[model samples]
Target: MTSLPVIDIDPFGTEVLTDPYPLERALLDAGPLSYLSAHGIYAVARYDAVYAALRNWQGFQSGAGVGLSNFRTEKPWRQLSIVVEADPPHHDAPRRVLANLLGPRAQRRLRAEWMAKAHKMVGKVLDGTPGSTVEFDAVTAIAEKFPPRAVGDALGLPEEGRENLLPFSDFLLNAFGPRNELVAAGAPHAKFLTTWVMEHCRRDALTEDGLGGQIWAAADRGEITHEQAPGVVRSLFAAGFNTTVHALAAVMHALVTHPEQWARLRAEPSLARIAFDEAVRWASPVQTFFRTAVGDVPVGDHVVPDGAKVLMFLGAANRDPRRWADPEKFDLSRDPSGHVGFGFGLHQCVGQNLARLEAECLITALAERVETLELAAPGERRLNNTLRAWHSIPVRARLA
Candidate 1:
């Protein structure tokens, strides 16, 4: 083929991570597929192209690895996630097992229990004693705390080493991109955190009553190989934790920043799911996921060479005007159903139902109590190659 547009942006640089929307907007303005000269990888940011690429898995596959370092060549930093890093045949069984285990029906048991826990948790945080104000960092207070407790209890993971989940997940997502400072900083601790995660995934480490045990039960049913069971369990925190926690933080930030949306949610608590999805679309918390080109694939206008790494900017596409009107605005009234906040197609987030349920429960409790939520100070971003995290978001929630 001929040539495509070239953008000189370092897709993972500190500048873009601080405020990514402008560079992302330029990506949309640049044709469908543009070469990031800084990284030497082709980039896709348009909504239609990204939406199509996610579906045409055979053409742009994840099996080679969903990171910059292709598994076909380099060894992965950790054991490959059968669910996140595999293609059809190998992916088939693990996907089915996770689908069966993590889906809404399987997680239905946690609905009422988690909801009750959330009410108690929020009540404690913003104890409404007539006319007093309660303030806390939503990141540490709710987002970071909820997932591990809910998921850990569900998986029967011991309470002792649960702190490792966040850093472990950060390292894993960073490993997907270039070995930059972010990944390097976590290198020393990777061994310990990774060891903790692997240990927890074991059938022996899990309680027979939780979902981790359910994975072993799937192993027994011939759904997956016995050896593959723990890795599948690993997928729970690997794919599920960082994404859900960060998204929760992002959505809470959105609601606090957009008082109208919070008011609407307070008036009609059922819009919790809608607000969550909208925040995801607006924030694009889980930023980039890579797919290697299988062959000479036609992406947008250019034919990419065989084995070229195609970096899909999910954050950019979520805000593409072609897909969303006034995409920058976090509007609860907006329908964010097709948003790539949770990827797309068969590889779509398997734990989405769980994430949605978490948001619903937490938001329901907050809506019932908090009269007005306002930012106590400017929020800080926890920059990572793949995740958009909040280091701290100070907010004061007043109860009427």
Candidate 2:
């Protein structure tokens, strides 16, 4: 067995949590695969190893959960995610249910409605704020409103419960990290999220317009039993909303910092879709996911013991110099679809199309209306165990 390179990633230190990108780049440069005892996991930083782990689910089972430990061995904050954390046969059902809900035809149906909503929202955001400094986080604030309402409406959640979307979704996503202040602070909302989702599955809470209603509809036909339908709605709240919200923030941050890129985007607004993909590759909102080794597995000359935790660094892999030319440069011309910002193979993000549509709508709206969008103040990065995010970004935009 080849000796693994060792690096310490002490979570207690703010450095690792705040900007693991530099550490990731260092690890990738040292070797494609390494071990970090301080983080208490084996790290796969290069594109090849990360891609292999994502593809070979049998070698790195999903039933173990996609966080720092095995769900079978260590209980997750909630029950394991059916789509994001489960493996085959068992993983197939929920994924199919969501695929149908968010399929191409459904996305097509959503595109025009969402674009119009985005335009209205951006119009309000840009209104009276032109030439005045407005925090771009407000744009994210404006942007975050759409997904949950859209997902809630699609899922059949009531109009009254829509306010629970952002707070609940934040708790759900934060729960993936180690039990810390962040997770503890979100407890009340997380509890509400659990109760709301489970109760909605009980058959009375759903409305005809949302997919929550559709899940119950499926349950009536025995396509999905009564037990699984609410979990599906919960999945939408947890997985669907938070990811898209932060992803939009990332793109906004990138465009603000990179003026030339913003100018190019303003000139060719049709490139909005690709800009979102590039932001995914660049910021990599979903930073890392852990995989548990099914057995002794050999990857890139090193052997990981059975049941060991393997951390797939999606952020690192996306910026890996070996696979991506000028990896650090945010080029709109680059083909970023191959990047693992959305995992790969069977476990790839099921809501990616919906996310792309939402992001595209917002980006295009901004590009069309703003002649120039630049940072008003330096941005701050929020540190989470699993997500790379921008906490605050103030901007000055010249609205057309």
Candidate 3:
């Protein structure tokens, strides 16, 4: 039997985070499974291996936590995510409640309103001299502004402290990796965001018409126990908020950087959702998630022992040459259906439909009004232990 290769490197180091594509390819080539000497965790970068591991929940358990820290032994810094950190019985109620509530069928009302909001917002930003280019940061103007207005409003959260959403999100995702400078950068706002999230996710703090209330209604209907209601709501808010924000930034950046892709989107406005999925494959937002091995789990020729932390590189797997043709290119022609950008199996992102909806509305709105999209300047990459984000993406847009 072949032994797993041992690599001495920090997967979360700043050098790797700034540009991971080269290393992503290297990891995939390192064989099916490898052990990270620096972090003492087993890693998988190939498409088939990562996908299969994600599907086998009984073998790679989420109940032990989906981060570098093992929940079986170490206490989690924050509340355990019911949606992503549990298995079978305890995971069923919340997953089903969110799956039914946030699916496409449930988003009919939100679809229309968000579409209109996207148009209005895009128009406001693209307001410039006719036939002249509009220069602005897409991340700041659109990505940062849209999710709070759309998803936050859908969740019936009070708009007063919505600005705290992004910073708070930084804390949540960064905590998934080792304690480092990235975690330190977001530490100052930890207390405030924690306090705010708890205060606002309560039943009284939400409006009756929003998704939050609907989760509560499920508990009222006895579909889920009343004790499980609050955690479900917190899970929804925690999972939904900033993920869409970074995903929006990734898609917009992809379109601007690839002029040909933007042209395709402009020609067929219906392709907005497809373009969004492609961008997710090209630039993964939630990079890595760790799962604990249940017992002896065997791959092609190696075995992961019980209680080992298996770090599945979602970003790397999405771009594996074995899985995608011209994997490095941000082409709209490729099918991104099986991509693990939003994860796979029962632990797949519960808010993914909502994310797709948000991106479709915004990208469709941009497609309608912008004749051309290009980068105004080089963008700044925001480094986080667990997230791929941009601090700014200056774009030059031509109004149609």
Candidate 4:
């Protein structure tokens, strides 16, 4: 049997968190499973290995918590996500409620309304630009603005305190990493955000037709325990907003940097969905998730010991050369179906349809109105433990 390759690198250090590709390459080159001695964790970067771990939930469990701190041993900063942080039996009910509530059929009711909202938002953005060639921060003016208004409305969150959503989401994603400065800085706001989220998730606070109300409705029907309902709502609150926002920013960054691809998208607007998926594959928004080994699980030539934390590098797996041709290049033509950008298997993003729909609406609206999209300046990165997002993506758009 081959011995595990032990690497001395801080996976949560600011350097790797800021720009992780070099470390990702090193992990992949080392082998399917490498031990990160800096953190005492096992890491997997290859697509095949990561995918296998994600799909084998019984072997690689989520109940331990999807971050560096295992729930079995240490207490989480907050209550664990019922869906993203649990395995079968316990995960099934909430997952079913959300999957059905946010599923394709449920999204159809939202599609027309969201598309109209996207067009209106795009028009407003273009109007505010001040010239035929208008320069603006795409992250703030476009990506950040759209998802909250659209999905927030859908979730029936109150209009007041909506500004707090993104910051809270950032804090939540950061907590998934180790107790670093990023997490430390956001810690103060965690209580306020938690209170706000919990208060709003109450059955009275949500509109009857909105997604949050629907989860409560499920609890009413006893599909899920009443105690489980708020956590389910919190799950959506935590996972839904920031991911779509960052994903939008990623797609915009990908398109503007690659003009030919932008032109292709404009020419064939139907490719918006595929473009979003490719962008996600190219610039993974949610980077890494830790899965605990249920028992001695054989990975490649070695076995991960029971109760050990195994980190799956979603971003690295998305670009694995073995799984994708020209993996580094962002191409809409590539079928990014098997990509782990939204993760794989049971814990795959339940809100993916809603996310894809949001992306399709926003990208299609932009493709229709903008003739050319180009970066006005180098974009700044938003450093977080889990997300690869932009602080600002300055761009100049030529109106069609």
For model 4 the TM-score comes to 0.98
lDDT score of residue 36 within candidate 4: 96
List the global CA lDDT of all models: 0.88, 0.78, 0.87, 0.91
After TM-score superposition, the amount by which residue 100's alpha carbon in candidate 3 deviates from its true location, in angstroms, is 1.2
lDDT of 2 by residue, 334-355 (tens): 8888999988988788889989
What's the TM-score of every candidate structure? Answer: 0.98, 0.93, 0.98, 0.98
- Tens digits of per-residue lDDT, candidate 3, 162-272, equal 898788877888888888898888888889898898787778888887988888899899878878877888786677767888899999999988898889888888888
Q: Summarize candidate 4's per-residue lDDT along 64-176 as a digit string, tens digits.
A: 99988888888675678888998889999999999899988878899999999999988888874434787789899989998889989999888998898899889988988
Candidate 3 lDDT for residue 131: 76
Off by over 4 Å in 1: none
> For candidate 2, what is the TM-score?
0.93
lDDT of 1 by residue, 1-400 (tens): 5468898988889888788887898889988989989988889999999999999889999988898887876767567778888999899998998888877676678899899888888888886585678899999999998898887788788888888998999999998889999999999999998888888888889999788998999999998999999889998878878889999999999999999888888999899999999989999889999999988999866977788899999999999999899988999888999999899987999888888998899999899888899999999989999988899999998886
Clashes of each: 0, 7, 0, 0
Is 1 or 3 the stronger prediction by lDDT? Answer: 1
User: What 10-residue stretch in candidate 3 is worst by lDDT?
Assistant: 234-243
2 or 4, greater by TM-score: 4
- Once fitted onto the true fold, the runs of candidate 3 whose alpha carbons sit more than 4 angstroms away are none
